[model samples]
Target: MALVTGGSVAGPGAVEAARWWMRMMRDPLATYGALGRRYGDTVRVPFGVGRALYVLSRPEHAEHVLVANQDNYVKAFTYRPLRAVIGEGLLTSEGDTWRRHRRVVGPVFAQRHVVGFAPQIVETAVAAVERWPDGVMLDAAGELRRLTLDVVGRALFGSELAGEAGRTGRSLETLQRGAVIGTFLPGATAKRGLYQRVPGLGGAIGQLDGLVQRVIRGSSGGELLNLLREGGEFSDAELRDEVLTLLLAGHETTAASLAWTFVLLSRYPAARERLEGEVDEVLGGRDPRADDVDRLPWTRAVLSEAMRIYPPAWTIERDAVDGDDIAGVRVPAGSTIAVPPYLLHRNTDIWPNPEGFQPERFMGEQQRHRYAYLPFGGGRRICVGAGFAMLEAILVLATVSRTHRLDLAPGVPVRGRAEITLRPAGPVPMRVSRR
Candidate 1:
C-alpha cells in the first residue's frame, strides 16, 4: 500500500523520521503536541518504508475516522499490547468478540441503568472523604483512585477494593508502562506469556489476576455481576477478562480525571469558588443524587472543562481497512490514524484560548463541531461506560465540594504522565480542608 501523500509530513527524511519515532517512544504526548504545532491538524509521519502514521487533530478527522466512514477503520496496532493483558475484553476486543462483550455489558451502563448506581457512588465518595483527617496533606491521586475503585467495586461487583487500590494502582502503573514499551517491540512480544516473563510486569499481572479472582469468587450478587454470571454467555476465562477490564477501565480513567479536576480547581480558585457555590446552592448540604446532576450545571461544566484540558483517554487511534479520502487527505489501507482528544481540545482553531481553564465553554449553547470535544471518544465504539463515568464524576465532585476543599500543597510539582491514560506523573500532594 502507498503511504499517505496529501497531508504535510512531520518528518519527511529517514533520519528525521527516526528521531520523531524515538521522541514518540520517549514522550508521546509532548511529541504529538509538537507535531501538531509544526504540521497543523493533519500530519503524515513516515513509519516504515511505505507506511505512515497520521496524526489527525481536526474535528472533521475525528468525525470521518470515528463516525462518518467509521466502518473503514479498526483499532490500531498500538492496542495489541493492551489486548495481551486484558485479553478479549471490550476495550481491546474487535469484530464478533467485541460485539458479544458489548451485548452483555452495554446495558448495565445505559443512562437509565447507570443512574441507579449514583447512590452507591456518592456514598462511597462520602465515606472516603470522611476518613481524611481535617487539614491533612494527602495524595489526591491515590485517594481518588481508592474512592473510585471502591465505588466500582461495591456498586457493580459487590466486592470491596479500597484496600487493594494501592497495590492495584502500582500494578496498573507497571502494566501501562510495560504496555507502551511493548508496543515498540516485535509482534510476538505482545503475547501475555511473554509479558509474564518480564520482571515487574509478571508481578503486576499476578496482582491483577488476584484482584479479578477476588471479585469473581467473593461476589455478593451485585446487579452487574449477577447479570454476567446468569447470562450463561461468558466462560470462566472470558468472565475474568471482562471483570478485569471493567475494574480497570471503570476506575482508572475516572480517578485520573477527578484528580486532575481537583488539581485544576486548586490552581484556579475562582473556578473552584464558582463550583462550590453551585454545589452549595443546589445540594444545600445533602448528598448528590442522579437527578441533581442537571441542576448543578456548573459542577458538570467544571468536570467537562477539566476533562477537556486533561482527557483520561488522551488518544484514540485506528487503522484503515480500506483506502479512502478523509476530508482532503488521501489515506491508504492499513494507515494508522490518531485522533487525540488532548490535541483536538487544544486546537486553537476550534477552542479560543485553548490553554485557559474555562468551564463556561461547556455552559450555555455550544456551536462547535460535533467531534470537537471528545472526552469519551466518538462513533459506535465510543466508551460504553461514558454515562456511568460522567454520573460518577459529577456526584463525587459535588459530594466532595459539599463538605471539603482541596488545595495543591505548597511548592509541590505536578506533571502529566501520558501512558495508557493521561494522569498526573507523580502523587498530587494536596491539603484537604473541611468546608
Candidate 2:
C-alpha cells in the first residue's frame, strides 16, 4: 500500500497533533467537530514516530472500514479500557471468541423473538411512569435509566434491577469517566486487578461486580440466562462478564437515547405536539403493544432523529491489521481510525440543516447512504441489541406520551458527556404533567 503521500492527506504535525490529542482528552466531542471543520473528512494525527490516529468522517470511509474491507480491521485499542471494565464480552471480544458469543446471543435478539419481550417492556415503562408524581420536577435521565435497567433485568435476566439503578448509574458515571483517562495508560494497566486498586475506579468496578453478582444469584430462570447456563459454553467468569456487558450496554444506551428524545421534544414543542397527537390517535389511552410500534410512525421517527443527533455509541473505531487505501488516503498497518456517528450524522453534505431536529427525515423513504446514519454502528460489529432497543424506545415513548408530558425545567442547561456513550452531562430536570 502507498504511504499517506502529498497534499491529498491533511492533518496537524507531530507537535500540533500532540496538542490536539490533549484537547481531545479534555473535550472529545467538541474537538472532533472542530477537527472535522478545520481539516475536512480525513485528518491524520500522528501518535508517535510511526503510528497515527486518523479521524475519518465520511460515510464511504465508514462503509470501507466497517463493512467492505472489515476483514482488515479489528476493534481499536481505544476500547481497551472498556474491555478491562466489561471483560471479554460481546462488546470487546474478537475473532473466534466474538463469533462464539454472537452465535449464542444473536438468536435471542432476532426481530421475531425480540417482539416477545414487548409486553414486559411496556409493562415496566407504564409502571415506572405511573410512579412519577404529576406537576413535579424530576431527572428524566435518571428515571429513564431506572426504567431501562428494570426492563432489561426483567425481560432478559429475570431479575428486578430498578432498585439498583441509582448506584449503578453513579458507578457507570465513574467508570466511563475513568475509561477515557485509562485509554492513555499503559497496556498492562488495563487489567481488572490494576483497575481495582485505582481510587474512584476501584469502587465503581466493585459496585458493578456486586450488581452482576446479585443478578446471577437472584436470576429467576429468564430465557436468556437459562440458555446461557444450559448451553454449558460459558464459564463462571465469562458468564459474569457477558451478564455485566448486557446489563450495562443494553440499558445505558437505550436510556440515553430516550432521555435525549425527551429533551429534544421539550426544546421543540412543535415536534412534541405532533408526537403526542400521533400517540393519542394510535393508542387511544392504552399502553402500547408490539404491534403498536409500527403504528406510531412519528414516535419511531422522533426516537430515530434523537439517536441521529446524540448517538449513544458516539464513535466506532478500528485499528488496521494491514496496509490499505481508504477512498484515496493511504493507511498503514496499526493505524487507529475513528468513524464517529456524531460527526457523520451532522455532515452538512448529506443532511440538510444537519443540526436541526427533524423527525420527517426518517418518516418516509430515505435516500441517504446506508452508512450515513449509524446510531447503532455498521457491519457485523453493529450493536446486537439494535432491534430490541428500537422496540423498547418506541413502546416506552408511546406509553409515556399517552398519559404524560415532560417539559425541560426552565433555565436548565443540558449538555452532552462523551464517554463510552454520548449522554446528558448531568441530571436532565424536566417537569411532568398529566396530559
Runs with alpha carbons beyond 4 Å of true place in candidate 2: 1-7
Q: Per-residue lDDT tens digits of candidate 1, residues 1-435?
A: 223344434434555768879998889999999988876788888777677788889899899999999899999999998999989898988899899999999999999899999989988998998999999999999999999999999999999999999999999999999988998887776799999999999999999999999999987978888888899999999999999999999999999999999999999999999999999998888899999999989999999999999999999999999998987788889899999999999999989899899999999999999999999998989999999999999999999999999999978888999988999997999999998
Worst window of 10 by summed lDDT in candidate 2: 1-10
- Show how many residue pairs clash in every candidate, following the order shown: 0, 0
Q: Cα deviation of 54 in candidate 2 (Å)?
A: 0.8
* TM-score list, all predictions: 0.98, 0.98
At residue 303, what lDDT does model 2 achieve?
94
Clashing pairs in 1: none
Across residues 159-208, which tens digit of lDDT does each residue of candidate 2 receive? Answer: 99999999999999999998888898888867888888999889999999
